[model samples]
Target: MKRYYQQEEDIGLFQRMQQDDPLAFEEIYNRYFLKLSNTAFKRLQDREMTEEIVQELFVNLWLKRHRLPELKQPESYLQTLLRNSVIDWFRARARQDGFAAEMLAQPDRQIVNATEQHILYADLQQAYESTIGQLPDKCRQVYALHQQGRSVADIADQLQIAPKTVESHLLKAHQTLRHVLKDYSAVAVALFNFVF
Candidate 1:
């Protein structure tokens, strides 16, 4: 009976969100943010990345409120969205060479032990390197510097470009890489410690 009442309340909040009620959205976010953050953190094991995944989920939820379909269970809907967001992050990480390093640094490394997994990793690694080589000179330069742990301001100063410009280049590089590697994510996410 209490669960049913909570579902009714959640459905009402979803409807209000579609009508642009910031308060309703805040209520939903407040209710779910910690749960979603903890869910993502358990899989990601990285605080910053988990926060990014959860924040982006809420941002997209608010941005696409009007288009969201009616939900019998908003919690389920949010969970599905969070799952996809985590997978998307995995895809982005797979495109970066540092992904290997990050995985290796994990105390309990989930390295590719199976031949099939190794093949997939090798293919993705090659694709990532190729994609990096194909980026526009400026975008590639900004991305390489950023990967080396340079701050946006530092990269901007070194490249004689605005910080915003540096960010723009990095965003472009990431978008391109994500697009190119999207197909491999479902498989890659499963083979790695990204299991939910």
Candidate 2:
């Protein structure tokens, strides 16, 4: 009975996709890609390979849309399928004897460069902090609360200011940061690192 209901839902979604419903594709992609990518990454341990596998999975999924009814839990099924594919790829490379050896012969440049990038990131971060420190007191406070993950409503309530005022302060803070960091590519990276 549960299988029947799931099949019906799958059919509905598949039909919507076939009709070129953008939201359906977006929903399906978002709902599965992260989990599937994580599963692939865990197995492959190569970021580029994992990304390629996940992208290929999405492309294959769309191409095989008519077969959606065969899936039990589409997301889980895709993850398992990707994991098996990664394992098979490793096995095939192992059978080729020198393939793994050649891959291992290359230095892990990305890991090595990441250390220097981290130091540069820290420097840019300090610069951003110093610039933010120069904001007007209320703007600094509002931006600080925002950086702490406080919502505008929560910040307004805590600071005893109107929400519009909190938003205005945040906007002013962002404008200031943009102006201060306009000359550096590191500025965007710094802001993203700080925000996230």
Go through the candidates in order and give each one's C-alpha lDDT: 0.79, 0.68
Please provide, for model 1 over 1-196, each residue's C-alpha lDDT reduced to its tens digit, 9 standing for 90 to 100: 3343345478898998899988788888888999899978877889998898899899999999999987986877887788788877776777585766676677355454345578888888787889999999999999988765466998999999999999999999978977888889555734342321
* lDDT tens digits by residue: candidate 2, 99-132: 4566566558545645766876676678788988
Residue 164 alpha-carbon offset, candidate 2, angstroms = 1.2
The number of the candidate with the highest TM-score is 1
State, as a TM-score between 0 and 1, how close model 2 is to the true structure. Answer: 0.41
Candidate 1, residue 18: lDDT: 94
List the pairs of residues colliding in candidate 2: none
Query: Which window of ten consecutive residues has the lowest lDDT sum in model 2?
Result: 187-196
Residue 93 lDDT (model 2):
52
Name the weakest run of 10 consecutive residues (lDDT summed) in model 1. Answer: 187-196
